[model samples]
Target: MLRMEILKLIRNNVVALIIAYILAMSIGINILSFGFDELAWVERWLPILTIFYVVILIDLLFWMAAMQISEDMETNMIQVMRTSRNVIQYFFSKHVLLLLFILVAAFLGIIPMADQFGFVLNFLYVTLVFSVVMIASGVLLAMIVKKQSVVMLAGSVVTGFIFAVMVRLVFPLWNISPIPFNPFEAFIKAYYYLYLPVEPPNQSYVALTLIAVLFYIISLYVFKKLTFDRGFRL
Candidate 1:
């Protein structure tokens, strides 16, 4: 089921968009490097590519998945799939596939800048986990809200709030200096302390991951009781 969703998504324009965006970001970084110096370019551009812009791009994929799911319900496809064993697992698998797509796109986008920026495997792991959680949360929001527009609005608003409040405001205060191999420090502190050398992974990555996971789990429960009208009734 997951494989099917992934293959279908690859046929869409989203993949092309990701590739084009990555190319553009890389080119922009190089062009800026000649004018501003390598360190400045990393500070100004890398975070935009790796964190901010990446979030918006991945949100597009999330929206696509929501629309696809809604379409399936409208066409009775979901009802048909529901008859199968482990239907919820199949639904969740689609979210997993979308998350993987986001992560791969992000990594590939960052690859072009690695020579100047350096790469951290831990950053990739945290980013991957964060992407997965966002994808799941988006799906869950769509299922709960039922109305497409409302789902999107709710997801965006809630996600924005969490990013601004929880990830940005809260995590920085935590003390993880004493614990070596601290996963929290590995992810968030890297974003804060190691800003340029490797384009420090966003300090909010770990917090975002946790929030997304919690929302995803909550969405699953809501989806279990959801019923689709199949007539654009929303």
Candidate 2:
């Protein structure tokens, strides 16, 4: 049943899914080239990770959710499901599918640059946690905003704010310690700042993973409580 539901979503959103991959990869490559050259060796990793998460992963997932799920709502399919089957399964199934899609897409973007950055496993772990958080945020927004345009707008704003906090505020402050910054150190810092990915020592990776998990639980609870009406309803 879960596989069938996932296949249905992929079939329905094939076009948007293709576009999302193209846009994410293009942006990832371009940023990798331009951003790395500008920063000193010491400073490049955080900036790259921040751009990958904030600009690409977070932004794309939100847009993908709005483009895909919002269409079903507009056509009243979601409303019909409320009366017939398990709404919780439907909601969670979509989230799982989206999370899976993001994990694959992130691999495609990060694998090529693995050698230049570091080990594939480290990059994969960071990308996976970052993707999970973005998916959780997008799913949570989708539950509330039924209209396509509104969902798109609200998701963008919400993601933008989260990025602002993570990259602009939390990370910079966390990285200011006089201690030398290395990739390993950066990873540890990120773990400590887990709420923001811009911090070093990848402590932020831990933060992102924990945050995504919490948001997923809250989103599941909210989805279970939502009563979808039989007719076209928001």
Candidate 3:
């Protein structure tokens, strides 16, 4: 079942385009920064990863989660699929496919920085947590709001924009603690700040990951209860 889900993503034209874009950006980012003698080797990758996760993958994963499930519901394919597999199995297979995409794009973007074990480890941790959090966020939202996939895709882009603003423009400028809203910030901050020589900012992110897990649990329940019934009503 998981294999089938993965193959579906692999064949998706958008997914192919995205992977090609990742490859282009991976090389392009380096090319654009070609002559920076002052730039540290490790410093170069952060931007690539930043653009990949912050600008692209977050919304992509979210939209995929929502759209794929929404399509399944709309066509009553989900009902058919559910006959052989429980709701949990169905949703998770889709979720894991997107998660795998995230890891692929992330590793591709950060390949140059691979020698730095510390940075690589932190980035992978954040990337995994981030994939789940963003997918859950979209799936959770989609389960409640019935709409076309295009509508949801647009919403995901807007969300990615807002998240970028919050993490890049707003959060960094302020010194205020975002205890209640830390997960959003921590997803970027956890690894972005790891290269700093100070005490690791690992604590908040660990807590944030737990919160993300909670969000995912809620998303699963919502998928089962909300989406599972919609096919019959249709």
Q: Write the per-residue lDDT of candidate 3 for residues 1-234, one digit (tens) a residue.
A: 788777777876777877777778767655544445256763555463454444466666777777666666566574566564566766767877778777877776666568888887777777788778878877766665555446454565447553654555334566644444434655656655654547466557668788889989987776766666454232
Clashes of each: 0, 20, 0
Q: State how far residue 5 of model 1 sits from its true place (Å).
A: 1.1
Compose the digit string of candidate 2's lDDT tens values, residues 51-132: 4443455456666655555666667575547543655555566656766766666555544455655444555565556555
Q: In candidate 3, how many Å is residue 70 off?
A: 1.4
Candidate 1 colliding pairs: none
What does the lDDT come to for candidate 1?
A: 0.55
Superposed Cα deviation of residue 192, candidate 3 (Å): 2.1
Q: Top TM-score: which candidate number? A: 3
lDDT of each: 0.55, 0.54, 0.65
Off by over 4 Å in 2: 1-50, 53-55, 76-84, 113-118, 162-207, 228-234
Candidate 3 similarity to native, TM-score: 0.77
Model 1 TM-score is: 0.62
How displaced is residue 177 in candidate 2, in Å?
15
**Quick one: RMSD of model 1?**
7.3
lDDT of 1 by residue, 100-166 (tens): 6666666654555566443545556656665555566556656666655565566565445434533
Scored by lDDT, the top model is: 3
